[model samples]
Target: MVHHTMATSTTRASKASSKINPMNLRLLRFLSTALIVGTLVACSTTPLPPASPPPASSTPPAVGAVPGDTAPLPPPLAQAKSRWVPVRWAELPGFSTDALHEAWNAWVKGCERPAPAFAPLCGEVRRLSIASPEEQRAWMVSRMQPYRIESLDGNAEGLLTGYYEPLMDAARVPGNGFNVPLYRTPAGLGERKPWYTRQQIDTLPEAQAALQGRAIAWLRDPVDALVLHIQGSGRLRVTEPDGSQRLVRVAFAGTNDHPYQSVGRWLLDQGLVRDATWPGIKAWIAANPQRVNELLWSNPRYVFFREEPLDGLDAAFGPRGAQGVALTPGRSIAVDRQSIPYGTPVWLASAGPTAQLGRLVMAQDTGSAIVGAVRADYFTGWGPEAGDVAGRLKQGLRLWALWPRQP
Candidate 1:
């Protein structure tokens, strides 16, 4: 669970220009003469009669105009959520040393549903998948412009937190030690704006009845189940009724719509714990087992999940992020969409007790807690090591957006 809320090179145009035929050259010369005559005549104040439209060409330009005649489109205006100040490549920390090749996989994944502004560059990005770090670096420097990301007030500093997919054992049917239920979206879930609070789902018969027969899997520990809920996704090793086993993923489907109240903050406010990390919480739970229900009920928000098979290449990546692509571990990050558009390539720099990172990442997801112009939630992948990193990483951060340069 998150502690705090928080490409390409080209010369395609030049290559196409070099292939112009003699016939096209003569047509261009004639058009240039016509343009000169029209410009001279336009000096008169009198309005000229509209001329008959010229015959349309059989082969239209790939771009909206005659390819060579069109000027490059300027970069988009600053996003409302953040102010982007143009900066030189030299200003980016670790620009000369970051392994650009390490980030290419995520770039390819992003091309599946790229933003309109980024759609044109996807081909070059895919071609560079096997490119050496130096070549990729050079391509980026030539093709993209870096901009220092800041808040509307020009605050360049922000907070960074971490999140990871949880992994745990589960049972197809409730029995033995696996009793805590992880459910699919309950019937009538959409009938009410806020379906049911966590406490209500636990104690109210009507709420419980609504969720009857919806459990997808039963986990051994309630805390482990809660971790899945908080993380919004997880992988489960399931023991079937027939004594067979399979690994499956449970992805976020919907929420109860209640506001999320941080359980850690609740403990802090009650003077019950000084450390609110997952380990600390588990330690506290070990000492005060009877109060587990009280601790969980502190937050009314509840999350439901959908089961997906873990197979083939899908097993190699995390769940689909908000950008609708499988997340690349250590390469995907959740950001405020208002601050940075989805599928944008970003330069991330952070140094803290838990980690010191300077690399490239993609903006592919978002979260309720991840709000702010410069704030981000790093996706640490799955399993125990990832959880350890996600549980403790909350530190200072800086970001730069790497966008395509003008044609």
Candidate 2:
């Protein structure tokens, strides 16, 4: 699954000159978080302590509680549950205006491993590459149906976020300020149920013993390393023990199987930082270095990685997504597998603190947080600029899945 991390900054207009260069590759990490409107709003605003859990009450208990119990069940969502509704292409907000040719690149990638339903249409999809936008639109119109996704109670809007690969400096040996080690998945991981939590991995001797001789690379900043863990992948500019430098990707290998707890949510609950974006989180860490371990242990989930060479064509494309295709920057989205099947084409529209976006995106990935029918996690690609955009993009979204018509 393609997981995405949430961003809190407002989106800025992208420069027209910005383009992806295969030779100049950047590392990206795909991390997914299950964020709701409350979390999104909390991340972007001043940090406030979560409402106190109800104080002990002397009164009798309400439904779902024992006679003396005061803890309450969480309230139901304010928005309706998720569902899908059929709609016409004409109803799509920016259907005709999008540059389908650009999206066609993503479609072609998906065709490499098309779903069973779409397998037969791959040839026609390829042949139409040379066709005009109007022709492509016509072909889609003729063969596909657009379904407007909604919540069970018919709420059409949902949250939109983004994630990207992060690039950082590293070393082969643990010295010269590169102290934190990124580990490969340990042997016999299969035998363990929900391996060590981040705290145990960091502090326990047995947990540390399993990782001995398994350091993939050593990093300077523990927070940077944690960011890599959260994203599930990252590019490291490694200074080898022999004094040579090379770029390599640390792709997701395995995890500790612990449930992911949002550190942002932890900070919000603690009333520490006002903004929980990476920048804000980093700021809090810098000012309170002593509390670093305390903060790191807040999230129990731990991710392991395997080194992958970033050379040739691999440098140009992203890590293979859940669809088994190299993700097209800005064109790939991670959705809930249950809501939108992999390889489906979708029209995405959103406007919020982040920039406005309306275009064609392929459902080449899935995320833990992308649960509802209308939810999506847009891929922002790699490098610092992509990270900037990824960290800030939280918006209201609408989606229409374009599915092949039944024969």
Candidate 3:
């Protein structure tokens, strides 16, 4: 079987020994907002451009048939990379260069990768001297649309973003799915918001009626709680009141009723909020409805839901007793609980904008797809940004486990 490799071009302001893989935190925020707000249609999701006037069915010179003598097949994505790419909003194509430097720079901007090579963009800029604003604008327009075409009508944004998760994994039990819920205009302005709970919805009477028997359900509030999935039987290593460490096997996935506005300080790396420190940020999000989406979308991590300790909350959201603080979390990942051993130290290589925030950070939690495989989803912290960023990314990876080296 033949394999294909893509050559990317990128410029380097600072050279580093290791490459970084991060996703766009801002985009993820929009994605989270997308669910609660509305489906955002980019050209990638736009209806296929009107088909090119049917090409004369013809044969190529290489084939036995003479040119213009046979049938014509649709060109490959690379061949037609420009035409099919969306030009709406942020999804535009970028300029191309035959020169190696420009080619190199483009690769860097496209994905999160370790760095050791010279700046591709520097070379492109210097060599072709095509770094002019006009050239740059044309180049950016060429960035392949991120995802398949989506609806842009505000009403459609929520619908499309809403379906991203269910489309990928059905067993995806919901928990205010987006870490930060969308706080849009008072209800009835647009589509109803989606919601979820920590435990199975079947347990709650309201959930049953809300779901109406669907494996999954949407929330009207958007800012519902999220329940992390627990797996396997590893004991949490926590020290007890007696000053001794204890082992408490944990659920691969756990449940919680945390809110999007609740975990700010920590998610954004700000300090704790003491007292009824004003509904400050959350209130602002609620009141600003006109373009709340744009404002929130600017900062990706702004929409993350936070775990305890950092946010002054507890394991469950308040003071979690000795269990929460001393929680010697069975080394595991949040996404795939059972698959990735709780205590194993794994290296995560993400391919998005978020990874740029925390480069090569440790992976303490576990998720389903996060098992032994070469894949990872950074806890994008928690909340809407976390949810949005987490859902949008899918990339190939390299994994390493921290263990005693073979003698």
The lDDT, on a scale of 0 to 1, for candidate 3 is 0.24
* lDDT digits (tens) for residues 1-407 of candidate 2: 33435323311101111244211222221111212211111011111112223323211122121122122222222223345566556666556666676677688889999998899999998777656767777788778766777777677778778877777889999998999999999998879988989999999999999999999999998888878876667778888888877778888888888877777777877989778877788788889999999988988888889999876446555667889887777788888877778898988877654555667889998666667867788777777766776777776778877777765
lDDT top scorer = 1
**Candidate 2 versus the native: TM-score?**
0.80
User: Relative to the unseen true structure, what is the Cα RMSD of model 2?
Assistant: 13.9
What lDDT does each candidate get? 0.73, 0.70, 0.24
Candidate 3 — worst ten consecutive residues by lDDT sum? 4-13
TM-score of each: 0.81, 0.80, 0.25
Compare candidates 1 and 2 on TM-score and give the better one.
1
List the candidates ranked by lDDT, beginning with the highest: 1, 2, 3
lDDT of 3 at 312: 12
lDDT tens digits, residue span 266-339, model 1? 77788888877777778989999999989888888888999999754455567888998878777888999999
lDDT of model 1 at position 158:
88
Write candidate 3's Cα lDDT for 104-124 as tens digits: 222222112212222233334
Higher-lDDT candidate of 1 and 2 = 1
